[model samples]
Target: MPVAQDVIRHAAERPSKLAACGPGGELTYAELAGKISGAARHLLRRGIGPGTIVALALADPVELLAAVLAADLAGATPLIGDHTWDRRRWSQVTAPVGPVAFVGRPLPYAAGPPVRREPRPEDPAWACFSSGSTGRPRAIVRRRASWTASFPHLSDLAGIGPDDVVLVPGPLVSSLYAFAAVHALATGATAVVPGRWPARRSLAAHLAGATVVHLVPHRLPDVVGRSGSSLRAAVVGGAALAPGTREEAGRAGLHVLAYYGATELSFVAVDVDGDGLRPFPGVEIEVRPEAGSSFGEVWVRSPWLADGYLGDAAGPLRRDRDGWVTVGDVAQPYRPGEVLRVRGRGDGAIQTGGATVVPEDVEEVLRKVPGVGDVVVVGSPHPSLGAVVTAIVEGAPPRALLEATARTGLDAAQRPRRWYGVLSLPRTATGKPARALVAARLADGDPGIRRLT
Candidate 1:
């Protein structure tokens, strides 16, 4: 069964349980099911199902959930659209995905039957835009069975049940928060989604007593700083999880679990209770290093992987003759199923002084240093070295602290030659350091980033 049908089961088993809460207020499973059924009927009556892709361009989390699950029930694949994107960003992602039934407006009501028939479990249930901070976004379509298989595995791993209240912070347009919201409903847990992403200082109120809160790692330090948070766990992903952030989370009595996942490969590896990154439940991963490369490409094989990019030839997702897929992420080849450390995207490597430096390798060392919250390392134009390794980092760190850490952990080529500081790095909609934007700022010498002595 698709995840949408799971909600119907919850409606029968625990009808009065809170299904979801957002700006539109809370809805019980029974109430939510009624709305989904009505909306799904409306979609099918209008001849939108299976073949038709429904673009859910909703900023309101509550409405998006209703519309998305309803679209699934109606057998139409829902494309989660990011409303926060400007016209240019939107066009960049959508131009390739031709002819979708864009649902920018509220869904119409059904005049007749509530449901015609169930959607195929094998057909696509959702399509989401890739949220890589440095690269062009592409639409990754997913089959209904992929999410269906994930619900049970993920819920069991997290111990989510009807008693848990899961909080999804980021906009639903981003796959991170979208999965969190839908996963909560699929597991019969109450999902609370704020109208907007909460400010760093205001996150505690949203987290208090919530069993689980899903967010990106960039915001983890600020969120963990707030006291009196009785959260069962804070599940973070979409960026490198800083060592300092995890340490701070421990001091605040917040359990933080980080996962390394892409829009194409749903949940590849997860760090449970700070044990370290291991293959996610039911996901098979291996590191395949190219010749003369220290870092190896991490390939994953799983049922949860996305179908494929919609209509883009230049996308990063690649597959071998075998069923394994890789997005060019380089990682340390630990023993088969043992702990893994993702170096960074291969295309993101900096060629400085005739040696390649992976930004994540440098960032990992810097992240362990005191006072560095988050960081992005890019190649700065250098006449002698082609491009020198330059770092634009968030958090106010003293010059001595960074220099000392770099000197000890990094070699000559890997160490950042130029150091710049910002109060905070610009983040994508998914809350990752916007590397492309920062690279532009570096090129233009934007005053937003002041040179660190």
Candidate 2:
């Protein structure tokens, strides 16, 4: 069944239940159903029908949710775009999927004929763009079943129910938060979204009523500092959580659940403890070892995999004849229960003096150093070594302190050859470090970089 139908079912059974809430407004199940019906009629009148691609650029979370459902009800595939996108970036992203219509705000309720088309399980449901931190973002398409199929397992794992209120503090443009909101609505839970980016005040207010929250690891420190409510669970992903960060979150009264996944593949492995992640129920995992390396590229086979990218950029979604797909993340099985220890992305591996260095390994060690807030390890150009491991730190700590910490924690090749301190590091919308931007700044000798040689 289409996800919209779930909302319709909820409206029939629980008309007075809160469906969504935000600073701008709140919606009961009945009200949300009415809005979705009206929006569907409006979309149909505008000539948006089956197979049509509609781009929604709205910032309001409630309105965005309604618009997406309405598009699906109208038999149209919704492509959600960030309203903050500038002209150049927007054009680069939407160019692949040819535009049909753009809706930036909620449409008026029209008393017109109801949309009669029913979306099949295989029908295209939604399209979301990649983070594009490495390059231009690509549009990824997924079928309705791709998400709904995993709802039961995910809901069980998340402990979501009708009484639960799920807080999604990030923008709808991010697939992570988008999934949180949609999954909440689909499962009869109330989705609480923030009105704006940064989401400090909005998050605090919603946390008072929210039972669960979706957060990126990098944002956890700030959120834990501000949040006072004791949540049942906090879902953290998008980037690796630094050492001691989970413990700090626990001290703040939040139980953290970290998972590893990609845009192409939905939820792959979920972190059971500090060691690594255990595969999601029913999901198959395999680690194909490289010729001369202990770590292997991680492959996943699951019902939640996306169909493919919308346009010509299809090379990254590598698949084999057996229906298994990989996003180039390298890992190894650490336990018998299908647990995996992710090494790093194969593309991000750095070759230095005939040795391979995963930046995440160095970053993990550096994060344990005192006074270090955040760290991103990258390869910088060197005279002898092809690339020297460099560490970019958020706060300006003495070189002696970092060097001392590295001496015991890291191997000789894994140690950072140079350190640059800055007030902050560049990050994507989802809070992952913007490696490309950081590399450019370092290469161009940005004045903000304090060289601790």
Candidate 3:
């Protein structure tokens, strides 16, 4: 069922219960349902009814959530517009939607015949912007079941209840936060948006009334550092948590459930505490390696993968004949129901001296070294070998620790031959290394990066 269906259901069960809390104020379930119904009716009035594709340009977090739910209520697929995107980027994403209806902000609630409609499992639900490290983002269109099907998995992982407040620090435009907000609403838990304020550290400073918080690994420090927090559990997604970060968060009484998922693949795997990642509930993982290699392209079979790219017809999301999908990620051979070690994207693989090396394999090992803030491993052109493994380190960490760790933790061919240190590395919105910008800098021989060896 569409997530909007749950919102409507929750209103009848707990009309006076708090639904969402933000800087503006609070919305009880009845209020949220009323507000969402009003917006949906307004959208219907504007000809954005069943199956219509609507682009939401709301700035407020609460407004964005309301608009998204309202769009679903009206049985239209909602695309969250990014403020950072240019006109060209916007056009590129919505091209396949075909004559999209634009909703600048949520409209005032007006009483009328309910526009509520139950969305089909395969019906277009919403569009998610890919976390494209390559600088180009594709709007991945998701189906109603793709999201609603994973609600049970999320509920079990986070252990949220009606009284529990779920905190989403990031903007709703981020697929991670969007999922979190809707999940809270669907489960009848109060959704908390205590970030995006002047300080921006509002999340680290205060968690509002959140008992279960969803955030990326980068925000763990601030969240753990916050005093007088009512938070009991933290769910970290987007990227793996570093050893130091996990330990630090553990010391603060927050054992993070770090999830590894993508815009195309909803919840593939999750690592509880510090254990290795295992397939999420109802997800199957397969690693197809070369003739003799241990690491191979990771393929996933899930009940909730996205419907595929919307705007651009060309992308990496591939679904094979056997119902398995892959976004080109490479990983070590996975044992069913056990630890799955993902290396990196297959396209990002490095072949140096006939040996294949995944940058993520090197990056993860380097991140474990003390004094190493961040690392981005890439393949640089070499005369003899096709390409040599290279490492870009953030901060002037002593070269000895990096060198020793690489030699001990990695194979001879996988160790980075060239090392460069930067005051800070270029990063994406989610705090991951900006592979495209870094590769461009390396290609241009940018002097801003100090060559270590």
Q: What's the TM-score of every candidate structure?
A: 0.75, 0.75, 0.75
lDDT of each: 0.76, 0.77, 0.75
Give lDDT tens digits, candidate 3, residues 1-453. 666667878999999999988877789898888888898888888778777778877667787788888888888888887655555666776776568877675676767987746556668887876642223456789888788878877888767777888888766766887888898998999998753422545654456457888876556666774677788889887545555877877777776888887778888898875778988989988887634334566789988899888754566688899999988665666678668876554245564553446677678889998888899888776644656888999977788888999999988888888999988886645566765457656666779888885
Lowest lDDT 10-residue stretch of candidate 1:
346-355
Residue-level lDDT tens digits of model 2 in 1-453: 767889989999999999998767999999998999898998898888788988888878899999999998888888888776665666777787776577877867878765577567768888886552223566788998888788888787767788898888877876888888999999999998884434457556666778888876656665664546647678887556777877887777677788888777889888745566888776788887654444566788998898888865643578899999987666654544755777554334454653457676778888888888899887775544656888999887788989998999888988888889989886645577655456556766789888876
Quick one: best TM-score, which candidate?
3
lDDT of 1: 0.76
Put down candidate 1 lDDT per residue, 1-453, tens digits, no spaces: 656677888999999998888876889998888888888888887888878888777767787899998898888888887665555666666778777777765676675665656556567778887643223556789897777678777777667777899988767766888888988998889999985567655566777657788876656665665567667678887556655778888887777878887878889988877778898888899888644445566799998898888875456588888899987676766666578877655335564543446677788889887788999988775544556788877888887889889999888778888999998886645576756456655656678899999
Question: Clashes in model 2: which pairs?
Answer: none
Q: Model 2: what TM-score?
A: 0.75
Error of 2 at 61 (Å): 1.5
Q: Give the poorly placed runs of model 2, Cα more than 4 Å off.
A: 86-88, 132-135, 195-202, 223-228, 247-253, 272-275, 333-336, 346-453
Candidate 3 regions with alpha-carbon error over 4 angstroms: 84-89, 132-134, 195-201, 291-293, 346-453
